[model samples]
Target: MYYDGIGTEANEKKGFELMLKVAKSSSLGAIHLKHHAQFNIGRAYFEGYGVEQNNKEAERWWIQAADDGSPNASVLAQTMLGMLYSRPDFLNLKQAFFWHSEACGNGSLESQGILGVMYLQGDGIKQSEASAYECLKEAADRGNVYAQGRLVQLFYNKKLFTKASDLARRVVAYTDVEELARDTGCLAAYITKGIAYACFYLSRCLALGNGLRMDKEEAEKYFKRACELDPVVSHDFHLDVAYGIL
Candidate 1:
């Protein structure tokens, strides 16, 4: 409908009118059509494409689209809803948990990983190690880099070294830590708690060859990476002895 406008002159109003007509249709078997139309309508409002810019209106449409269960729109809505609830300013823990769970169940890898963290730390939901492990494992298995990193930390905390080492190797293959005070996904829970829980126990295994083959050079690499990610992990021999404290 806007094709003519694009070739001649910009006509956002005309585009918006056409989009509204399609979005208002009550026809069946038009799930994708409705979903996309609604999404575009929301975008139009948000971006002032053909209407007055209004975030509240945009969010309302997005929420409706998400609840409509259009696959793509649902995912987008899930993400938007999760982000809205997760914001420190909004801080609706119950709603955040609900939407994140919905998104996770719908295969949003980021939601799965974040939901796992919430479960592990009891931030928004009741802490349940079993649930945490299941969500984190699912996300990690899907090759989400951040999820893989967090899974390594979780398994390491549980003394599941084989699992930890396996995941750590996968993460190291893709990234390295340049800062300790950020969300690289691996140390987020540990950092936020300010307790220095030693997120890189598997790194020591690589360095000391305890259950894994000893490779001092590689150990040193992981040591530096760990320390940069969290200063608490300066390969503190004392923490190793005080393991149960964290």
Candidate 2:
């Protein structure tokens, strides 16, 4: 409780001691403890936090934790391994896809989002816009900001303006840009969707000469904001179309 802050202030020392205690008594707890400890140890090694920085050691511990069925740890390990394999000297696209697929199958939103991008871009897998859309939509629905931005792009490509606008509204309502900036985290998928939707709305407003004056600048700003958040191919493509560049 103290370790997790359930009922008391968080204490890493106490948490470590309690983990050790649990490991001594139950095999399940032991496995979890080992997995968590190795994950933290890997991070420590990777970041040089109270330990000498060592990518190899970090990989080793991450792999051990992954082998122990720690889903998140496995995802991180697989991503790192994939990155290593993707180097010019290695150039193993197949292996990269394999690890990424494994992590995606295990429900890692980051992996899914990356996989979606890869599919969309035909990076390693065959280019399949439909597949990318499906993957991104699933991840976005799960609250991945990156995925949400991609989803907005997908909607724009399909000319589904109403749906896109709805998605954008949801993002604007649910996301906090300041908080995301502080952590350098992606905005919630909905937020990206909302920006795209807002851009589309602005464009429509300009075309119809609604209450707002016909302002290309305002429309462009919204579009730029959407691009800044996600920058998916479809969003860029649509921007070109809207500006007569397509």
Candidate 3:
């Protein structure tokens, strides 16, 4: 099953055969086998792995898994279906929003983040800054870095500078590696959240000549710390200051 052509495309047929073998011998293993088979097969078909790309097959498998009460599979299926319907070719914004909303309700952080993006951009849903904030915040609170970054963006877009600063500080404070080692689940997420918060605070400090004295040296230090902790932070424009390039 590890050789499925979904993520790596190693040996799909062999993988499926192995999964079937294990599934027949153990009920517990069967549940996981079924879930993986359904999800991976759907992904393979959707992405055209060893077979002609077919959204219909993908949708079918995802639906079956979801109906079987696989939370992860269900959320993914709903999200993908939402994306399919949201395209201009289909233009079913209401349907897209509905599916995404359902996925979010199923406790999918990815869905929450995607829905936040949709709400923020007014795609497949009416533009509601408040709604976007709520969605992103929900994910962020659960330690989703993408959602935390989006929350920062939303705050900045709406000129909620003070709130953004507060959030940024919180991000930096909560994402310490030391604290994370003591915690569990989503280490990468905490790191990302920390970087986002650090960047925001560093930017504000530079802009206002706050306690840090507006020194390029101090700013670079903080930026470097952020980048070292989370590579994604390097994509932010503040990276220049962090990397001492500025």
- The clash tally of candidate 3 reads 1
lDDT of each: 0.65, 0.61, 0.64
Q: Report the C-alpha lDDT of model 3 over 17-89, residue by residue, as the tens digit.
A: 5644543445774665565566666676777765668877777766665553345554566666666676666
Off by over 4 Å in 2: 1-29, 68-76, 79-92, 172-174, 177-217, 220-246
Best by lDDT: 1
Q: Which residue pairs collide, candidate 1?
A: 207-219, 209-214
TM-score of 1: 0.60
For candidate 1, lDDT tens digit of each residue in 1-246?
472375667678887887777778876756557766676677788677779988777778777767744346656566556656777766887788887778777767667877887898897788999998888788767644556666776876787777677667656654324343233333343332222223355556675464568787776666566666556444463376469443
Q: What would you estimate as the lDDT of candidate 3? A: 0.64
Off by over 4 Å in 1: 1-31, 37-58, 68-73, 175-220, 223-246
Error of 3 at 69 (Å): 9.2
Error of 3 at 124 (Å): 1.1
Q: For residues 92-189, what per-residue lDDT tens digits would candidate 2 score against the true structure? A: 77777776687777766666776777788787789999899888888777766666656655665576755655565455454565575334333245
Q: Candidate 3, which ten residues in sequence have the lowest lDDT sum?
A: 181-190
Which ranges in model 3 have alpha carbons more than 4 Å from their true place?
4-10, 17-36, 47-56, 68-73, 83-93, 169-246
Worst 10 residues of 1 by lDDT: 190-199
Model 3 lDDT, residue 239, Cα: 59
